[model samples]
Target: MRSDYFKNTAYVRKTAVSSSIQKLDKKDDELAFAKFFIERLNQFRKLNYRVVSSDEESSGADIYATAENLETLNLQLKTGEPGLERFWGRRRKLGSGMGIIDVNIEDLLAQIIRDSEKHYANKENLTLLITERYQPVFDKNYALRISTMFGNSSFKGIYIVKLPSFRASFPYEGQIVAIKDIFGNHGEVF
Candidate 1:
């Protein structure tokens, strides 16, 4: 009985450690993405900005950025292609050899709008930053479509940061598109 108790305690300890490690890994990923996002935005817009401490992240914003001559902005960062899990599930059921998986941009936009409405309602100075790691294309059509979805969103801006796969040669830092501009107009790429 004592041996079983010891084993259970050990298992609990291992599980706790594993959970802590996972949390740390997630935090690390968020910090790395925030740094990359800020650097790219600064380069493109010629603005100086710094990410606020992680402790401030509990306010429903993944990141908080501060810049001179600008209001402190609350950034909700989402990574990964929206609806990617469903795509993978479909591919698996079809037996794997499916050539060229295409992500549905409309579905992605709809998901973002839903997330914005759910999480950021009545929040001022909030921006939705989606880091699409698998989107193959970020073009004018995508910008316009994304912008159209946010006609009544509470978010001040919606930006998609397209980080290409390891195969792309140009735009090593990836691309940024303003789906909805803070100034209340259709967005443009930086």
Candidate 2:
């Protein structure tokens, strides 16, 4: 059975999304990715989440959503490959032996902190969702790093949506690798 969300019959052709992504300059990629992500996210009708538009100047999250049993979620979307070095602390280049397809969990957390402090100060929870062009193989290790790093913050989760390629045949997919309940429970699955 094709239980994966991205495997839905009605899906965006990898070519369409990739070609579109390739044509965009860096400035517009965030918004473009946000739009694309939201469209795919809304497919889960059972979840009853409504994806709302956000204005860059005033919105803390790239996309906003409302659902039962939780406060408004601030989904701060980030794109591009994670850098080779951690933002703070010891600097070490990620060598090819470790693989180039990865997202820097530390840097992403820093951004979430900055964005949440500035715009999501009053919000209940924060999630940093990154959509990468290449498939990353380190989500499990990265999740453990995040849990150990920011175990006290209200930042509840980090999700990765990987779009393998723009070849029109590849499928776009995602998964919530790590999550916690700000209310006390750890590793809550969504």
Candidate 3:
């Protein structure tokens, strides 16, 4: 993938999001991967959830995994992490200018919460917007892009995650080696 051609480093940007998903690269493939990931999560059972869409929010979580599993809790899954990193540290590197980051994540987060609530309210189903998380190939804390929005307030920030961190948290065993590499030298399993 083209991501492989780039440096291992990660970047945090305030790039705008549009009403359409067409601008997103390989969206179909990404959705497919997200669905597959949701399936895997469901195999763990323990929780009953489904993939839901909110016209108000626009963005669809990989899965709506809900549970009383206090440890697991309720979550909205993203192909990548959802909460963003703070860009307060990047201001110094932008030639001592104003903050380098753009857009307020906190504001965006609020919009999501509002939309999520209003969406289900019409259906007469009470659903709490518990938490949002991302699933990335590499480091999570320092992912290539830590996109986030804090609801209830207009404050927002984004930060960059170094490559080294990504390498550490990446689900290597899940993707790097073939299924056989793990189950070992055995033949295919149906």
- Which one wins on lDDT? 1
The per-model lDDT (C-alpha) reads: 0.69, 0.52, 0.30
lDDT of 2 by residue, 16-88 (tens): 7877777555536655555554454545323455566567588666667776774666677665355322321
Using lDDT as the measure, what is the rank order of every candidate, best first?
A: 1, 2, 3
- Pairs that collide in candidate 1 are none
TM-score of each: 0.76, 0.48, 0.26
Model 2 regions lying over 4 Å from their true place: 1-46, 68-70, 80-120, 123-125, 139-142, 164-172, 179-190
Local lDDT at 36 for model 3: 41
Cα displacement (Å) at residue 3, model 2: 63
Segments of candidate 1 deviating more than 4 angstroms: 56-58, 85-103, 164-172
Q: How should the candidates be ordered by TM-score, best one leading?
A: 1, 2, 3
How does residue 18 of candidate 1 score in lDDT? 100
Backbone steric clashes in candidate 2, count: 1
Estimate, for each residue in 35-150, the C-alpha lDDT of model 3 and write its tens digit: 44334444543344445332325533322333344232222322212333333334335553332334544344445555654544232222222221322222322122222222
Q: How far is 25's C-alpha from truth in model 2 (Å)? A: 6.4
Model 1, range 1-190, lDDT digits (tens) per residue?
9999999999999999999999888777676666766777788678888988446435867778899888777777776464754665676678762345454555767686686677665555677777665434556665676667664667777777765346555334467777777655565665
